[model samples]
Target: MAPARKEKPIHSLFAGATAGAIEAFITYPTEFVKTRSQFGGKKEGPITIIRDTLRTKGVAGLYSGCMALVVGNSLKAGVRFVTYDSLKHKLADKEGKVTPARSLIAGLGAGMMEAIFAVTPSETIKTKLIDDSKRPNPQYRGLIHGTASIVRREGISGIYRGLFPVMMRQGANSAVRFTTYATLKQFVQGTMRPGQQLPTAVTFGIGGIAGLVTVYTTMPLDVIKTRMQSLEARSQYRNSFHCAYRIFTEEGILRFWTGTTPRLARLVMSGGIVFTIYEAMIKAIGGREDEQ
Candidate 1:
């Protein structure tokens, strides 16, 4: 009967952070496979990568750089949701409705911020550690060691190896994902009765669908970003554009979607898990603000 109070940025931050950590922990092996496939130097399918990894390095190798991702992704998600929510609030009309285009802009802004502050460094470290783990003798011991080594050798830029591509990828990724999710969730919520809340299953499905769309739409950028951040790829490509050019010219066009299988798998689950947990966390942490 009462009006729903405004959404808090702090709640968004905490919910998004918790959601990201849980999603990363659960879906990381798929991520490992996707990154290895995208590395492309020794290109292999999901099955082959898993088999070889298990054989050579055993189970733990599948999670070689997980800690880096967990930490980075948690921070990234927190920043992303907070930024997106804040921007959406700013862009909304008198009644707080944001158009699809505005939603896209907000998500793009969020993605760019997270990419600059969190994703590039995190991804660079994770990519390097994975590369090192596959070597004859791995150089970096763990997340701390790998990061310290990178800082020591290349200074700050080392950790931001693929900033441009990462920026583009994350921006496009979040734009597509958030816009799609917001539109779909809004539509779904519209169908509900007054005083009703969205079902968790519906939220999960909507988020998964959004992620699926984003994967196909942004696959090439994802592949390029991974390659650019690679430890072995230092001398290979001059820049992100050059890396993309070579992958297209030398490896053929389809090469850009190298890790689609695992990435697709991961993102579906990840998107669903992230939004579901995020919603749950919001409800738990900030109390329900259900629509009436």
Candidate 2:
């Protein structure tokens, strides 16, 4: 008889990339509204923000930096899942099973990798889009023009303006997210009947909860990253730390969570979708050898 086929690394990467892309597209409008509400500083609620933006900029405006989002998210998810799987396997071999601590380490590594390779430029464009929309006289029209303007005005370095804060936020965010998911999955599985596999619904629910926790916990750093990256187009602050301190002092503690409502909602939906798809793909590929 022929031997069973092994799961390819690219399969997981592609799965993650595809899932991330789909989720991003589905939630792009929400994302646009969220970004505007969070960073635009327009004195209005989320619904009003969306209505006004669409009224002025139209549907295309809602997807202003979608290309950047797609490319960035695809790479981020691909690298994150691939690295996370690789690290988990290596750690499992050495330590014999996944633990929260080990998962945290894996998440940290994955987060750092994504932050360095993907988050900076992607977030920079996203921030510019949000900030520019609030501008009295906007510079670039959309994603393409915004990208070109950044390159022409400030060069490549400008694209990675908030590298440190991005790394810090994402690294901690990943650490918390994956570690919580891993630990919680184990707990949920342990509580189930013998030989029972974790249900898809349960996994999605848990992942959503984990994502909300991570996003909220690390939201302060995210605010700093957004402000820092947005500075590429304008002359507001000097660096990430300075920007953070200024916001904290000037805007108050609540300022760090300016648009947290949309973020929480986005995380709940996106996190559920991404993790559900990821687990489904892993199962479809017959990756799990033994279920608890």
Among the numbered candidates, top TM-score falls to 1
Using lDDT as the measure, which candidate wins?
A: 1
Task: Mark the regions of model 2 whose C-alpha exceeds 4 Å error after superposition.
Answer: 1-7, 40-44, 93-96, 134-138, 193-195, 231-234, 287-292
lDDT assessment of candidate 2: 0.78
Residue 9 alpha-carbon offset, candidate 2, angstroms = 2.2
Error of 1 at 47 (Å): 0.3
Question: lDDT values of the candidates?
Answer: 0.90, 0.78
- What is candidate 2's CA lDDT for residue 187? 87
What is candidate 2's lDDT per residue for 253-285, written digit by digit as tens?
Answer: 887887677777877788888889887887787
Note each model's CA RMSD in angstroms.
Answer: 2.0, 3.6
Question: What is the C-alpha lDDT profile of model 1 across 17-73, one tens digit per residue?
Answer: 999989998999999999988886656889998999999999999999999999999
TM-score of every model?
0.96, 0.88
